[model samples]
Target chain A: DQQVKQNSPSLSVQEGRISILNCDYTNSMFDYFLWYKKYPAEGPTFLISISSIKDKNEDGRFTVFLNKSAKHLSLHIVPSQPGDSAVYFCAASAINNDMRFGAGTRLTVKP
Target chain B: DVKVTQSSRYLVKRTGEKVFLECVQDMDHENMFWYRQDPGLGLRLIYFSYDVKMKEKGDIPEGYSVSREKKERFSLILESASTNQTSMYLCASSYPGTSGFSSYNEQFFGPGTRLTVL
Candidate 1:
């Protein structure tokens, strides 16, 4: 069974627009959520993250929102640039447990 | 900066052959992980090591074994390569997450090795 899932396989947006990527989880024990951005052949880079205690966390143009009650989280990027195009993965983990990753959503920002 | 390096960018092996994939991390991390990424399956952990000589099987560990002789290097061995095992292999490293109720450590991954078993 998949504990974490990214329902959307891909998302596209225009430059300078907002891009939203959603993720859901079935495990209630997960207390921390993170987003990672991956280029074509490179490893994934850490993006923003949020603790379950907080509803939202923002870093520069990236913002991550967590809803514990709904078991869902979303990453928002404002003024999305072409460089923002890549695969986004949502990961969640509990204390002492290995992180579970979503299938990843490919984001493409057009000029 | 944390850097994880894999032994190869691509490898092709025949069935029944023994294959070894090596990974090295420069950050002196205590945790190392091996995962296989497929088109729709994303990334699935094959094995992980918490310390030198200590290893744990992840969700999928069949036909795979791992070794961590040194703190900086981890090796994944395929007992007998199979066609189904062809996929992109990824290596990751992270610090030990000992905090109670919070295992929020971020993992640094390698560029990945594409392995093809024919």
Candidate 2:
């Protein structure tokens, strides 16, 4: 069973537009959530993360919103750039630190 | 910056051959993890360690074993590599499991080792 799910496999957005990626989880025990961005042939890099206590967290152009009640979280990239195009993954972890990752959403920023 | 390195970026092996995958982290983090990534399946955990000589089985650990002898290193072993085991293997490290949400607790992944078994 997929405890964490990214229903959208791919998303396309025009350059300078906003890109939003969504993720949902079935495990309510998960209290910490994170986003990772990966480029081809490279390891995934940490993007943004949000805590269960807070609904929103922002890091420059990247922002993550957590909806505890809905078991959903989202990543928002404003004025998306070409470099921002990549496979984005959302991961959730309970108190145990064993993280479960979603299938990932490929973000394509068209120039 | 912390860097997690896998011993090989790619490997090819024959069925029944014993295989060893190594990983090392420079961040001195206490937690390390092994995961296999397959297309459409995302990343599936194979094993993880929180301290030397301590290990735990993950979501898909049927064909894998792990060893953590030192603080900075963790290893994954395949007793007899099989065709179905062929996939990109990744190593990651982070601080101890967090009970609360913290962005800095994000795990850092290695470049990944692509293994092909025939």
Candidate 3:
């Protein structure tokens, strides 16, 4: 069973606009959530993450929000740039355990 | 900078052939993992190792095996290649966090190898 899920397969946004990618998880034991961005023919890179204890964490233009009660999380990128277009994956894991990944969402930023 | 390196960027193999995909990390990470990426199915964990000479089966381990004889190197093996095994393979490594939550350490990934089995 897939414990982590990304409902949307793709998301398109205009450059300089806010892009929101959402994820949901069925496993409540997950305490850490992470987002990874992947470019064509490249490996997934670590993006942003949020701990279950905190509701939100931000780093410059990227932010991750976690709603533990709802078992949901979202990645927000402000002023999206054309270079930001890539496949984004959401993953969650319990302490010291292997992570569960979502199917992934492809984000397209139009200039 | 943290770096994980894979043996191949792409490979083609025939059915019944044995294949080896090797991964090495320069970051001195204690945990290493192998995952296969396929369309729609996303990234499925094949195998992982938390220490030298130790291995654990992930979500999908059938027909696949892994080796971690050293801390920096991990190998994924396909005993008898099949068409269904064609996919992109990713290797990742992460440090064991001080808090005992290995997930706390961000995983660094290699460029990945695209393997095609006929």
The most accurate candidate by lDDT is 3
The best candidate by DockQ is 3
- Model 3 has an lDDT value of 0.93
Q: Fnat of candidate 2, please? A: 0.46
lDDT of 2 at B80: 95
- Angstrom error of the Cα, residue A6, model 2: value is 0.4
Candidate 1 lDDT over residue span B5-107, tens digit each: 9999999999999999999999999899999988767788899998899999998999999999999999999999999999999999988866632247899
Candidate lDDT (C-alpha), each: 0.92, 0.91, 0.93
lDDT tens digits, residues A1-111, model 3?
889999999999999999999999999899999999999988999998888889999999999999988999999999899999999999998877788899999999999
Q: TM-score for the first chain of model 2?
A: 0.98
What is the interface RMSD, in angstroms, for predicted model 2?
Answer: 3.2
Q: Write the per-residue lDDT of candidate 3 for residues B1-118, one digit (tens) a residue.
A: 9889999999999999999999999988899999999887789999988889989899999999999999999999999999999999999999887864376677889999999998
Q: Could you tell me the lDDT of residue A26 within candidate 2?
A: 98
Q: Is candidate 2 or candidate 3 better by DockQ?
A: 3
Q: Candidate 2 regions off by >4 Å? A: B97-104
* TM-score of each model, paired residue for residue: 0.97, 0.95, 0.97
